[model samples]
Target: MNILGLIVEYNPFHNGHLYHLTKSRQTTNATHTVAIMSGNFLQRGEPALFDKYTRAEIAIKNGVDLVIELPTMFACQSAEFFAHGAITTLNSLNCIDSICFGSEEGNVDILYTISKILVNEPDEFKASLRKYLDEGMLYPTARSLALFDYINKFNLLDISKEKLLSILNSSNNILGLEYMKCLLKLKSNIKPFTISRVSASYNSENIDSNICSATAIRKSLKDYNNLSLIKNVVPSPTYDILENKLINNFEPMFDDKYFDLIKSIVIRENNLLDKYFDVNEGIENKIYQNVFTSSTLNDLQLSVKSKRYTLTKIKRTLNNILLGITKEDMNIVKDITSIPYVRILAFNDKGREIIKAIKNNSDINIINKFSKTSFSMNDKVFKTLIDYDIKTSNMYNLVYYKNNQHLLKGPMDYYISPFYVKNMCFKK
Candidate 1:
């Protein structure tokens, strides 16, 4: 089945995503589309606007045939680690033929060249990069300068301002390149595909006429009640479902129930703050400083904001705060490359068949109920994840004020229940 794979958060399944899914299939002969998704939390470290099951359902409705989670440990961290986790998951799947992603610059050779430079790491390259950073340039600016300098000297890496601007201007494209770097490192069977993004900006805060950014959409959803903009832009099925969900007294709930827990972890145990994944360079101190003075998540972020600390970095920082992810934990995460197993959230007939096929001839454990598993490592991790799920749902159901559901409402129940499944009408 020439399977195609995508690593996505789908936060709310916007138009740009729909385009990417359609283009992914057009670029591959893959019979099935598989996505390794982020769970409740996302990479930049913020709570997903919608939960994982909802996001996965949206992906399935839009195009994906099967959805497996990119575990919370990796899903909510820095790009390099996130890429390592994602690409490793793709490699472990053991069947994906190609991995498709959206990039601002669609030049495969150029991206590959840049990927090689990042990996091979010539001695002088690090020196030059260090020198640039010492001069107070942000990491992105320093990295870009280093690449441009190398390209201009050899006239090979393609340093044209237009070309550089094409990819470096957006954070998403930066992460996309990291994915390429990680893929090359793994040297897996999955071929790479990059589709140039069209008609949408990643962080634009305004809803464009027809092509709106997810950031803008998220802000609008939080700030306004009229979703005319969303109604006009999101795919019909998504639009209908989202509308029903919100209109039926369902307030848009975010994953913030453990806000105090994060604060407590950050402030109570100074050393524990050092445990979060990617907590480095005195960031634990930053959390210590912020947690003491802040009362809300927004305030905590504001207290910690600085030039070297990008918002995305802050997001990940907060994530580490909550997860207690430490640098040592990262070391533990790095040694494990292959995905432990494929964690299914929801599926239809095609998805069912795929599961059946895997069961008939698979080697790895296929966990239908991560809640029930006793696979030592998975048992512990899955327990914490589902706990978070039930907590978030319980909290969200309250923010809208319909009922006060218990935080740990499900566990022998629908705590991690696959939200919904839409039967696809793929051409026979």
Candidate 2:
């Protein structure tokens, strides 16, 4: 069973993602591909353009064999934890032999260099990094400058090194490298490989030249006529699945509602507001000041803006606070001892075989039902208030959609791919 693992967030699947999935299959020579995808919120702090299930549908239609949702707890985390969660999930599957990722450089040695800098900061490098930080530079800028200084100390910034550093700054390679580093640190036996991504910018916010980022896709969703822009970028089947959804009343998440809840949580934590993740450097005071002054979420963020921190990072920190996670929670998550719980959102006949392999496996939690899901929401409320020093949100009415799994073993999985289903090709 030569299975390959992919860490993905097909927030809205596109042609670039399809390309990566295809390349992953060929590179690993694997019969099955497993995707550990993000759920609800993305790392960028916004709800996904569509829902995770829809994205998984796109993936399964395109090339992925099995789709498992990465739990919300780990999905909206920093890259280190995100990668850790994904690697842990893949390793638990027991049959996964290779991990394929898209990289800007695709050279293991170069990524290892940056990984060393992050994990093993030498004295000169630390001093250089500190000097840059003291100058009030943003973390990325400071790290870039310090890295250059440190590399120059040893006359190592040759053209190739410079190119690799530039690649490290590119979002794809940074994530790809982090995946490798996580696998390395775990001491897992899975083989790792990279496939260079093509024709898509990680943060591009507009459709151009048949390539568009999820940001671009989401921004254009309301424009009906422009939905074709996405149609051209995803696999024909995946694209078809999206046409009706491109501009429908189906709301995946109520961001405004989440914001109001966040504000309430902030206001109620008057005394312990300093304990949340990213609530440092006087950010807690800003949260307090803004909670009283601003009525909207964006307004509160504006009140706390600093040159050193990006607004997105600030939003993520706020989310961490809302979730009642602190540096301590993060520390504990790093040492979690459970296997990844795989939940199928959509799949093909090939995916069935993958499940068959895990059916009797005694090593990990191959869960198909939700009642048996660990980490209950009820327990989190207690943990949040007691451990993370934060107040809990009111257990108001919540939308809990039962998953649609008609495709599990029916014709949808056997024949109708994502696009075909969207196109009505398999309709009776």
- For each candidate, what is the lDDT? 0.71, 0.66
Give lDDT for model 2: 0.66
Q: Which residue segments of model 2 deviate by more than 4 Å?
A: 116-161, 222-229, 244-248, 252-257, 292-295, 326-328, 337-340, 359-362, 373-428
Clash pairs, model 2 backbone: 15-233, 237-419
Question: Residue 40 in model 1: shift from native, Å?
Answer: 0.6
The digit string of per-residue lDDT tens for model 2 on 1-428 reads 78888888886787777667777778888877778887656676655656665777778777777887665556766776777778877877777798888776766566666666766677989999899999998777788778777777776545454664597578878777677777666767888888776665777777785666766776666444465656766668666766655444343343444677688788888678777666777777777887878878878888788875668777887887766666766655565534435656666777777778867653555545433445454544323322221021111113212133332332122232232123211100
Q: Output the number of the lDDT-best candidate.
A: 1
Q: Write the per-residue lDDT of candidate 1 for residues 1-428, one digit (tens) a residue.
A: 66788888887788878878887888876677778888767787877765566677777787678887776667877777888888987777676788888777776677877887888877666878999999998887888888777767778764686677566666667777788888877877678888887776777888766767777787887778566668776887677767766665555544354577677777678876666666767877887877877878877777778876776788788776665555654565564656556677767566766666656644545666656555356554344544443444343333433432344353322446554465685531
- What's model 1's overall lDDT? 0.71
TM per candidate: 0.85, 0.77
